[model samples]
Each structure stands twice: as C-alpha cells, then as structure tokens.
Target: MADLHRQNEHGSRNRTRFPTQPTPSAPAPELRGHGLRLRPWDAECDTDVETWLRGNSDPEFRRWNTPVKLVDGMEDARESLRLRAEWDAEGKCVSYCVTDAATGAPLGHIGVNDIDHFIRTARVGYWVLPEARGHGVATRALRLAARWAFTNLGTHRLELGHALGHDASCRIAERCGFLYEGTLRGAMFDAGRHDAFRDVHLHARLATDPEPGEGEGKGE
Candidate 1:
C-alpha cells in the first residue's frame, strides 16, 4: 500500500494549512457518480477527515496500505487537510471527500496521486468508511474519479495498486475497469511505519479502455 498520509510522490514531508471555504464566486468543482459525489475537502469535513486518519492508523488499515505515522487523531486531521491543500496547489495531487449523493454525508475519500503531466499518468487511491462498506461506495467513487481524470483532466492512464492481500481493494479496482498488470515484489508497508516492504498487486486503466459495470470480477 502506498503511504496515504504522505503528500508527494517523492515521499517528502510537507505541511498544509486549511483554506477558507470557496466563495460563491469560486465554488468547488463537483464530481458526481451514480449515487455519490466527490468534492474538494472543506472546513466542515474535519471530523470525517479525522475519522479517515484514525481509521488508517489501526492495524487493519495499516496491514494493507502504507503505514502512516500515527499522531493524535484531531491533530493528524488538521495536518492532513493542510497537506491535501498543498498537494492540490502544487499540482502534486487532487483529492476529494466522497459523499452520499442525496444525504450529503461524507462516506470516504478518493484521490489521484503521483501525477505526472508529462506522462499523463497518475495513481488512484481510496478508502471507504466502515459505515459505507458493503454499499459499493468505493467502486462508484473510484470509477467517477477515473472518468474525470481521463476525460477532463487529460490523464492517459491511471494506476491502482493494493497490498496483495487486500482483496476488497483489488475488487474495487477491477470493478472500476483497471486491468491487472502484475505483482510488485516487496512494494508496500509490511507491519509498522518504515517496516519491511510487502508485495503489491498492480492494476491500471488506459483512457482507451472500456468501463466495466457493477459486479465485474477482479480479472475479466
């Protein structure tokens, strides 16, 4: 698993500050899916943001994703928001709060990382809140973001990878039309932060690929 807490592809440490909510003159761009919405992280989302951080801090999330430097939940949430803002402003990444389309409740987060304009490629990652699990939130959010990346953001290819044991993430990637590429040996966090690397499975979707509908299995 890639480090969800890190900001840049180069693995450099940086800090970000929360910015004021977008005004009416510059409302945040909205990305919609069948029953989901992806919007820029806003001030009101700190709680959900903290949830995401603390969720990933546990052994369950850490086992499959890159280990995060654990900190106080609220403190990490504040810093995560600022780091996300910095990533966006630096053109390093674009992240969004995944929400319920009708109720306007945040369910999770999804984003593109390690973006390289010259290559027109980026890596896609996401996490679903516990309550959102089994609702197909992650697959929908991922597909929505991938479509926007290819059609609107000039991304030619989007990469998705997960720890070899993360069946759910692999399923979500496949359902979103990412083709299985191969396994990367020792490519992820093993146990603790900076622990030995674990193997990872790589998948990717090209702009020319056809979209897969719901229920699609891991490999077509």
Candidate 2:
C-alpha cells in the first residue's frame, strides 16, 4: 500500500487528460452502479449544479459543511469552473459533479482532494443535494470516484475523515468498507468557530481491497 501522507505539490506525474474546452459532442462518461451514475463536472451543465448547490446549502446542510457565500446567480457554477481549471493545471486533485444517469440531472458533488501522487492516495469529500439525500447518491458517487482514482491515477488507497458526532457520515464510511483507523483531536474547524473538535474518524480503502461492487458504496 502507498503511503497516505505523501504530498504531490508539483504537477510532474499522474495528470488527468481532460479537454480544456467544454464539449457537447458526447454525453459525459457514466459511472454506473446500484441505480446511480457519476460523471465529471460540466460547466455547460452549470445551471443544474448551481441549482442543486443553492437549494441544498441551507442551514441544515451548513451545519456540517463550511459556509459558502455565493455572490449572484451562477457564482457557484463559475467557482466550479475555476476549481476544474485548477484540477487541470495542478494535475493532483480532481472533482466531479454527480448526476442521475437515468435523468442526467445533477444530484451532488464529490472529489479527491489533497492528492499525493508519490503515495498514490487521496482524501475524499462530498455532499449531496437536499432532495437527493437518503437516496444513496453520496455512496454511489464515492464508490465511483474511488474506483476511478485507483484505476486511472494509480492510487493505492483512499482516505476519508468525518467530524465526530456525524453519525450519518460515520455510517457511510463503514458501509463503504473503510476501516475506522482513529480520529484527530481538534482536527478541523466548522462554521468559522473553533468548537470542541470531535475526534475525526479516519477510514481507508486500499487498492487491493475487493473491487467495490456495482452499487451505492459509502464514505464520510
């Protein structure tokens, strides 16, 4: 297994080959699983992405996620575009916009962050839209993303961390086959306040782990 802490600061290897320009020529590749599909983020589909983010980033969702300040209409889409651009340039991290294959509508967002090519591991983070919650969108999205990372980027392990008290997220991690390694004390701050940070549960799925079945898998 690859070291999980190695950092990839330079874009020297394992770069993803995505077209610089948005192409409507073909539908985004579908990552099919238990009744779900995960695909790369499409700026052309910004309308859907914006709608999902705007509708879901309410106080309820913000309870866990860092507060997002949106400027005007479509700012979220613009930010998504910028992040993709960074992904292209950095050659390390990648993000995807999750959607329902049957309907091609946006359901959520997931990404591999803090990627370390030398170690061939990356951290996973995700959020599902309000209406799409409890329907296994996050699990499906995470499974697909992990598979892609391991297959395409030569990743050996995927790591996930969830705040303490996030029972739902903890369940997701366990269901997805991640081992609860341990937690970090005061590891993260939420909502701009340094609340007593709960022990973050760390979980990892190795490349040698059985190929994730085609279905909704879990990661917090």
Candidate 3:
C-alpha cells in the first residue's frame, strides 16, 4: 500500500490539518476570600446537578436574570460543562463555582463575561441557589471576584445589570460597592413575565473606587 502521509517540499512528513486533541492550558487559579471560595469549573467533582437544574428551572430566576435553559439529565450537564470550558479557554469569560469555605459545598455560580481588554471593562453576573440565598453569599462572592478582576486581570470597570424588580440583586450589587448608573428601557428579555423585553437597572464599579470591606485581603 502507498504511504498515507504526504511529504512536503523539504522531504518531511506533513502533519494532519486537524488536531486530534485539544491544546492544554495551565490550570486556572482558585480564588478565596471572605467566607467563600471561587474555583474554576471541575465537572468531575463540582457539578452540582440538582442545584443547577433547580435554579435554572425557576420561573422567577428566568424572568429576573439571564437564565440557563432547563436541564433534564446528564447529557445537558455535559453540554453545559463543554460550553463553560470553551468560554474559559477563549478568555472571553471566567466563571467560578462559589462554595462554602468551611464545608466546600457549592453555594452558587458567578462569572465575569463580555471582557473588553482594550477598554479594561467587563460584565459580571451571578446566581445563588435557592437554599443559599439570604446569607449574603452573592455579595461576598461578588466582592472576591471583583477584586480579582480589578487587581489581577487589569479590569478597570465592572458592569452589572438586573431587572428593575430584582431588589435583592440590586442590593447585592450595592453591597459589593457597585454604584447604580441608570436604567435601560426594554433592554432585557424576561421569560416568566410573558414579556419578551423588560427594563433593566444598570450598575458599575471602577478600579479607582474603594473596595468592599468584605473582600479585603490581609497582607501575607
């Protein structure tokens, strides 16, 4: 049989056009502060299927926030993992699983997306599991993530937006030191309201602003 590989002009075997494997990356660093720990997605151990499925399926969550579609089984979880990994690899977004510091159980999820390095800005979003709400989990996690974004990733401005009716989310943004900017009319899609579009309240925090006390790190 003829050789399957072709020789180039230099008389060396030419590599295949398509790679058989994905390029490896350095492991993402884990960020910890306050009462929470923020870790990169790890499907094997960190896949909180029940929490994810329930949180995303809530009609209130779907209406007030950009929600993940309902998930029914393992296949959906795997797809979610694949998409998250793609986002992390592309540097387009950095997502974290927020976990309790002492117990190591997942409390929720948070991320900074829409990264614009040229403008040194990004959009932040988060969701707390139903059981984890009312304990300030989102606020602490946001502060830790925001500090990392500003100090480590060179992000100068972080933006957060919530549906106008989400008073809890607005409070979390405020607790994390993000100032209310303005409202955008018909800027969001709310699924539970039978309305395709709804107004959103905008908030932002800048690197030059004072950091939230909850996330302040002790000198090491």
Candidate 4:
C-alpha cells in the first residue's frame, strides 16, 4: 500500500470503469468561500513566485512536507509552480494558492492531488504560512477545497495524511469531517530527510459524509 501510494496510484478490486470526463473541470475554477479563495498557482506571476517560494521554503512547511524535487531557490520555485500548472493541465492534480478572499494575499497552499476518477479518490494536503498560523486558515481551505473536489471532480473520497504527531493537522481533518482511517507506515519521507521514512496518520472523507458547518462566507 505504501509503495502504491508513492506511485500516486491506488489499486482497487472493484474494477469499475469511470468515464474520463476530465475531473477538476479543467482550467481549475477559483474556489471562494468562508473568507478564502483558492486560485490556481501561476508560474508567470511574480507574486505567485514569491509566495510559493516563501511558503514552500518555510521551516514549518518543510518540517512536514518534502517535495520530490525540492524548491531550492527563486528559479526552482517558479519551476515548481510550473509543474503544478502542468499537472493540472493533464488532469492529474488540482493545486491551489490559498489566499484571503478580500485582500487576495497568499496565506497558504492546498491541493487535491493524484485524482483518480475511476476510483473516485484523491489526496489532499495543506500548510498555513507563519503569519496565518492559529487562525484556522488551513481548516477553512481544506473545507473549501474538499467541497470543490466533490462538486467539480465528482470525487467520492478524499484522503488526508499527516506525520503521526501532527496533531494540529489531525484536528483540522476531523473538523472538516474527514474521519480517522488508519496509519500508513513509512508512507512519507521523514521531516527534512529524504533518506528516512515516517508513518502517516490517514484520514478520509466520503462524499456522503456529513458536511462541516458553513462558517463566515457563502460558497461560490
């Protein structure tokens, strides 16, 4: 299972065939709700490049996530965003730059990745910037992205995994109605180390699961 996860593909006995209707609806619509707007990451935009670099290079974010190709500097950040945009173009993932709905300032990142429409499942991950910590930015972004995934991608299941001790992320998952599923041993690279591995606490939410309460703003 861990190996399959690493490949970004899920194996299922169901053998069901779902139409390739291009999940994520292509071009990735802006998801606005609850004082947050999730827009696609743009490599050509300077603001996107700076925020992408800052967020991805942040100590706190690196403590949890290690991209397959590390963003080492400004050019790397632009390339990273370029890859995200390309992945979305290929309908393999939908990445978003989470920002304040009113101010349009980048506050974090959230992505519904490895979308398998036939299996109707995808993985989700997020990080809150230092300035945005303790303000529920991650929670809000997760909910908005989840809602968008289910609606636009027809995604039946969304999976979230965090390092075993990431209690804050676990709580955010729970708050968004993603119930604890199980632990995947050595499912991810250990914090700041590509050579070591760490266990991941898995959580999942079904399309039919009860929705989280609507908070401050209406969905768009």
User: In candidate 3, what are the lDDT values of residues 138-182, reduced to their tens digit?
Assistant: 888888888888877778899999888888888888878999999
Residue 214 lDDT, candidate 4, scale 0-100: 56
Query: Residue 150 in candidate 3 has what lDDT?
Result: 85
Q: Quote each prediction's TM-score.
A: 0.80, 0.74, 0.79, 0.87
Off by over 4 Å in 3: 1-27, 44-46, 66-72, 193-195, 215-220
Q: What is the per-residue lDDT of model 1 for residues 146-177, given as tens digits with 9 covering 90 to 100?
A: 88888767788899989887888877877788
What is the alpha-carbon lDDT of model 3 when measured against the actual structure?
0.74
lDDT at position 148, candidate 3: 83
The TM-score of candidate 2 is 0.74
Model 2: lowest-lDDT 10 consecutive positions: 19-28
Candidate 1: the clashing residue pairs are: 16-82
Cα lDDT, all candidates: 0.74, 0.67, 0.74, 0.85
Q: What is the C-alpha lDDT profile of model 4 across 2-47, one tens digit per residue?
A: 6866544555656556665354446888999878999988899998
Clashing pairs in 2: 34-215
List runs of model 1 lying over 4 Å from the truth. Answer: 1-28, 43-45, 214-220
RMSD of 4: 4.7
Error of 3 at 44 (Å): 4.5
Better of 1 and 4 by lDDT: 4
